[model samples]
Target chain A: MTIHYPKGMHHTSQVTNMMRTGKTTKKALTFSRRGMGLEEEINVANDFYLANRLAVIHKKPTPITIVNVDYPARSAAKITEAYFKQASTTDYNGVYQGHYIDFDAKETKNKTSFPLKNFHQHQIDHLANVLSQGGLGFVIIKFTSLNENYVYPASHLIYEWQLHKGKQSISYETIVTHSYRIPESLTPSLDYLVALDEWLAHINK
Target chain B: MTIHYPKGMHHTSQVTNMMRTGKTTKKALTFSRRGMGLEEEINVANDFYLANRLAVIHKKPTPITIVNVDYPARSAAKITEAYFKQASTTDYNGVYQGHYIDFDAKETKNKTSFPLKNFHQHQIDHLANVLSQGGLGFVIIKFTSLNENYVYPASHLIYEWQLHKGKQSISYETIVTHSYRIPESLTPSLDYLVALDEWLAHINK
Candidate 1:
């Protein structure tokens, strides 16, 4: 007997089409148009990067506090009750080319500005911690409506986070000027590492 | 309404007691005697490490594929159906003093050899990948029966993994000779970083 799994829960074949066309396929475009998040796309890209031995980044699993578990006969243990816990760190983190890369991917429908509310205090703290230890920390912000993505450094985000305490948002102009724009690609989809290299070079200079 | 969560699911008070006594408490001793896992102890250590700004390691949450969710009025979404997914990497990973540290904590009741079957192939591969990228990868193997823990480096494990193709386990002698014995402590419990430093120095020599 075969068990049918739910869609979007597993790796999707959209990666193959994206690899071939260097863009989202008609099906994927439709799915995204219907409000599917950028997370799936980034997961696929991370998979691509891992397969090619380019990077070893992974999305940290959602922390859940298991309340009750059931053991059915001759079957796997099932979590009958669980509660989602707030993550203390970012969504993605791993080693890339001997550098520790830590970041989260966020998408904004607002084309004018990216709300600081999209980031949490703990995440900012985690990123700052990574930076203090000589690691690379940044966020990949996708202006979904505008069809653009930017690699905003943690330092810049922290600055804006403190500067706009009352305002609570960073204008698009500030992001575009302060952040490095990630170039779109076929296999990796969001090649944010390119932007990371540029940002590292700029900071070092 | 108050929710009485299960014990050991959240951060336990064992850490505070351990901090004061520099050893496991009576309750923790009783729990361990009753076959409770080492995951809780390690988690407390990780917490202590993070709080002191010494390291930023964390256990990757168990991946679960959610099939159904229900959003009740003004409450968090409840996952009605979900299944555990196989993790692609090791359990614990983070930046430590500008070095990327990745490892998994495993316990075995066997008094002699540690069964090779205790580790998954994917985890071995992931560790090898981390090693290739100049990161530190090791396994903290606890011999529960003997009340001892050892930090086994990834390179040694990979070597043994290939050497013991026909054999199913690494002899106790082999592990003791090849691995660094982690000195147990109060504040951090298992101070494996000390073993890591020795291993690094050995490799550099």
Candidate 2:
């Protein structure tokens, strides 16, 4: 293996780069293991953007309400016990190509139809708010059973969710009718932002 | 208590409004005990805008680099081990009032100064990049010791950090010169957006 830098050439960026990541050898023993979480993959993709100075995007920390904390030291506040809280809005949002982007990710095991139950009312409400305020909003739907992924606009998700009483799930045919498929790649693997390009082209005109 | 319908109400919105969060009093106590995280509070504020058809804003999820995960079921994939991959940009970024908003929140225990150690070079670069793009960017600093808060613009943070090699912390006096104090009682308590408002007023002219 070739080393990238000399021993004495340590810099601040190099230190932060080290703090940012670690090299994992691809051991032949691992694939009962799944890859990154949906959020984490997106973060790596965003880093690809940051490395090239393309567009700026990021993910907020998992919001844990720290009910109890042990101040073991002066600087470190260890959260001893905490619980997860329902997120009020979409999980991903940022600026790209002079446009605002907001989205959420949901995965399903079903092969043919995606259940509307995976989405919550707050998410729907959040999407409506972003759209009303004139920002682009959408969802990344992953059909893990088929390894298929698509970007469906939040407008569409809310529309389908509103019909939950009458219809519990949206058929794959319907998703195909309205959603855009994301191509698999190294960076921005979900690559749903391509759908955003189409949305922008159609709307900006 | 009596169950009363506020007119004809069967919709989900009505349901959410009807119950005391749809849990037993004991369960409700546990649920209510869970406080929203900083990101969630910001999300709640964004939801208010969404619900009222105001500006669009959202918190992105933290990007993580997944080294290992256990898929016990087809429906649920649990990430057993993961390290935070370095993010290329700031924590929070979104659109508001047709303008781009970007920021990071850092808390410190010191009442007299905010240590430069809390921020990194990458965050500074991200903020600088946004400003270069003609976007609004800032930092939200909370003095947990004094229970006081301020929104210091990114330009100032970068400026001070450049001086960090010479002086390790940004004195409170220096911060006060270049930052905006955010008071409590706003619907979105951080209300750093107000600082952005003043920033826009100053810079756009």
Against the true structure, what is each candidate's TM-score? Answer: 0.81, 0.61
User: In order, what lDDT does every prediction score?
Assistant: 0.75, 0.63
Per-residue lDDT for B1-205 in model 2, tens only?
A: 1222223221223224325334454354334424644556566666665444446655555555444445666544444444445666676666776667788878787999988878778788878877665567888887766655677888888887787653489898888789876544235444455555556667769
Q: How well does candidate 2 match the true structure in TM-score terms?
A: 0.61
lDDT tens string, model 2, A77-174? 44444444578777777766555667888888899999887877877887776766556788888787776678788788878887775248989988
Point to the candidate with the largest DockQ. 1
Identify the runs in model 1 with alpha carbons over 4 angstroms from their true place. A1-36, A203-205, B1-36
User: What tens digits encode model 1's per-residue C-alpha lDDT throughout B1-205?
Assistant: 1222222222333245346544356446444445446787778777876776667888898998766667889998777666788998999999876778889998899999999988888988999888776688899998988877788888899999988862499988889998987654445566566566567668779
Q: Which stretches of candidate 2 lie over 4 Å from their true place?
A: A1-40, A73-77, A165-167, A186-188, B1-53, B56-93, B105-118, B129-134, B140-152, B163-195, B201-205
TM-score of 1: 0.81
Alpha carbon lDDT at A129, candidate 1: 83
Compose the digit string of candidate 1's lDDT tens values, residues A84-118. Answer: 88998999989876778889999899999999999
